[model samples]
Every structure is written in structure tokens, then in C-alpha cells.
Target: MMGQPPYSRTTIDELLRLIERAGLFERQPMVERKIMHYSSLQTILLVGEGNFSFSSALATAFESAENIVASSIDSEDKVLRVYNTARSSIENLESRKALVLYEVDATRLHEIEELSTRIFDRVVFNLPHAGYFPGGECSKEAIKKNSELLSMFLESATKLLSLDGEIHVTNKVGPPYKKWNLEGAAENYGLYLKESVSFQKADYPGYMNKRGSGAKINRTFRLGECETYMFSAV
Candidate 1:
């Protein structure tokens, strides 16, 4: 099903304030509550979650024991070589009662039988790169490939999001990444930006950066400068 129109809107400052309140950042800006509260009924999905690298975020989210699902395009074999954890990482996620699926394409999420019937309140993707190494050149082809990947993911994710639900993607802010025009891509799917906030690596205790596709490859992310973007159906 297509997503409903977007409603809520937020500025960068307001977004940062909200994320800070959620205890998602390394240092709390000005917390007025113990934690941003949510019901156990909320559902979350993480696409392109390699090796459970952002496992800490998973842990925090798992605290609610809500309907949490994590998908990665890479197979278990690839995860082992790239993430160096074997199946243990994913096993850990499953142990926490998370729905872990491999060979699951973010763009094809609606095709899964177990997931097709479900709707999530929050969906997240980090450094949504097709397959680029750090300090790499940004060719026109590379940019196009990245955009296409994002376009596909947004198109599919929106269909699985509940009304008022949001899709959050965290990404670096330069070179090839900036050219992706994530906001514009979401807009193409009738989604609008609701918030944008700074992201800190140390904020999530169990988080790890992308390990690329091979053991020899380097990480594809920048810790402090990245920003978290939330888009809602519109």
C-alpha cells in the first residue's frame, strides 16, 4: 500500500532537541526527562544493518522488546568476512527476539512474507551507500547508483510504514553522500523531511561503523559529522 501524506515538520534545532531528549546522542544537550518514552507496541526496522555493526542501537531499541526487524543485503558468509563476527552477531540479535533476515534487499522488503503483513513505526538505514569505499572518487555513475539505491529503498519502505510512522536514514555529509539528495528522493515517494539531527558515534554504545564488503576494505562513515534524517509520508 502507498503511504499517506506527511504531516509533522521540524527544523534542525528542534530535531536536535528531540534527539537529545531521546538520549540518542553522545552528550545530552538539555534533558528534561529520564528518557523519551514510547510504547512496546512500536515497531522498528533497520535495513542494511551489516554485522549488527549498529548493534548498540539495536540493544537500546530491543529494550522495549517491540517488533524489531533487521535486514541486510549481504549473506551470512559475506557478513563473516567483512564484519569478522560470523553468524554470532546475527544470532545475538535473534537471541534478543529480533527478526533477523539475511539476503534481504532493502528495496524489496515488501516481498517478504513475514514482513509484508507488518507495518513499522520507525525504519532506519545508516550511510546508505550502494558500495563505495572511503576516500573514494565520486563519479557520475557512482552518484547515480547511490541515488537509485536510495530511491528504491524509499519507495519500498514507505509502503511498509504505518500512518505517522517515520523512516530515518543516517548518512555522512560530503562528497558522494551529499549529492544523493536524500530529502529530494524521499519527496519523490511523497515523503517529507520531519527532522534532521547530528549523529555521534559514541552515543550508541554497541554501534560499529560499516566494514565494507570485504575484510580489506575500510569503513564508509564519518562519526561526528553525519546527520540523522527522518522522513514521513506525504
Candidate 2:
């Protein structure tokens, strides 16, 4: 039987208010514009979504049924322990008819038989961190792991992307995050960097950053200079 239509987790008007409050509505119009684009009925894949906060926003912002595929590497148990979000929260997405898959590694996406033939209009990965560390610091090992993960993800995801489609990856703006070289990593996978805009919490009103992995803070206390990098197949 066909599942019920999914409900949005948030609204554009609400998000706009948050962006305006953060004083980013003008300076970061790029990401805001992208968020607006999601309101259309487009096929979307939200990868590396921990606790599915951003994914939930996408569902709320989107206007399609079973069009948003939200995936995370961790299993339900891990999501519960690390994110403190009940299994029902994640299960509710599926009940809403959004395809919510736990334990789906973005890098190893080809392994998922169901997703093998899918072509998404928008593929998104937010704050692609290996996990939280001392004060949200990513060590050299964490840096390398993230680098490899991003590279593999770009390579795999590009193959499943539709033409005229775009891939979006957001990350911490500085330090270990910048070292991953998001644009460079995409280029290595035959993808071209399109545009990048600074990320603001206000831009996504109902969205929350769940660091997961035993992290103390849900939102990492950092310099608060995150950026959303967009890319497309070259």
C-alpha cells in the first residue's frame, strides 16, 4: 500500500524570520535562496543527517510525497543514545511516508539496492563531521576520515544524481573543517563547485544541530562560521 503524504517539519516564513534575526538574510541570500527552492516538489536526498534535524526541515519545506530520502550512518540505537531523539521520531518520518533509512553510509551508497536506480534532484549533507571532539575539534585522524568520506560520497552520489541537479554539502567554516577542502574534494569526483554561502541557524528555524556520538552539546560551541557548499557534475 502507498504510504500517507509526509508533513513538513517547518515553514519557510518561520525560517525566514530566523534568518532575519541572525542578521544573515541579506549577507547570505544564496543559501536562503536555495532553501526557497526546496519548497518546490523536487526529489531530495539528505545524507549524513544525524538525528535528521535538517532532513526534517527539508520535508517540511518540500512539497512532494516520498521525495525526500533521509539517511544516516548510525543505527536506531546509536541515534537514540547519541542524539537523545526517540526511535519514534525517526520512525514517524517513515510513517509520514518519507524514506528514512538509518545506517545508510553516504560514502557506500552503491551498496543500497533500492537507491541504486534513483536519481535525486537535490542531494544535501549538513555539517559533515566525523563526530564531535574536545570542544568540537576534529583531529588529524578525524580530518582524514572526513576527507575520505566526503570524497567517496561525492563519487557515489554523483552517479545517482539527475542532470541539471545539484549536490550540497555544509560544514564548519574553519579549522579542521576547512582542511577537508570541500570544493577540491568535489572536483576530485568530477564535480564542480557551484556556490557557497555562510550557514546561519536562523536560516533554518526548526532545525537543530545534533552533534551525536556522545557529544555534550547539541550545537557545537564554535566560531559559528559555517558554510553551505554547492556542487554539480562537471
lDDT of 1: 0.74
Please give, for residues 10-63, the per-residue lDDT of candidate 1 as tens digits.
566688788889858667233222112223356778888876756435545545
- For candidate 1, report its TM-score: 0.76
Off by over 4 Å in 1: 1-41, 64-66, 86-88, 133-137, 218-221
Task: Report model 2's TM-score to 2 decimal places.
Answer: 0.75
**lDDT top scorer:** 1
- Output the lDDT of residue 163, model 1: 96
CA lDDT of each prediction against the hidden true structure: 0.74, 0.73
- Residue 176 lDDT, candidate 2, scale 0-100: 71
Candidate 2 regions with alpha-carbon error over 4 angstroms:
1-34, 63-65, 86-92, 132-138, 215-223
The digit string of per-residue lDDT tens for model 2 on 138-229 reads 67777777788788888888988899889988787778777787788888877888888788876664677765555363444443888778
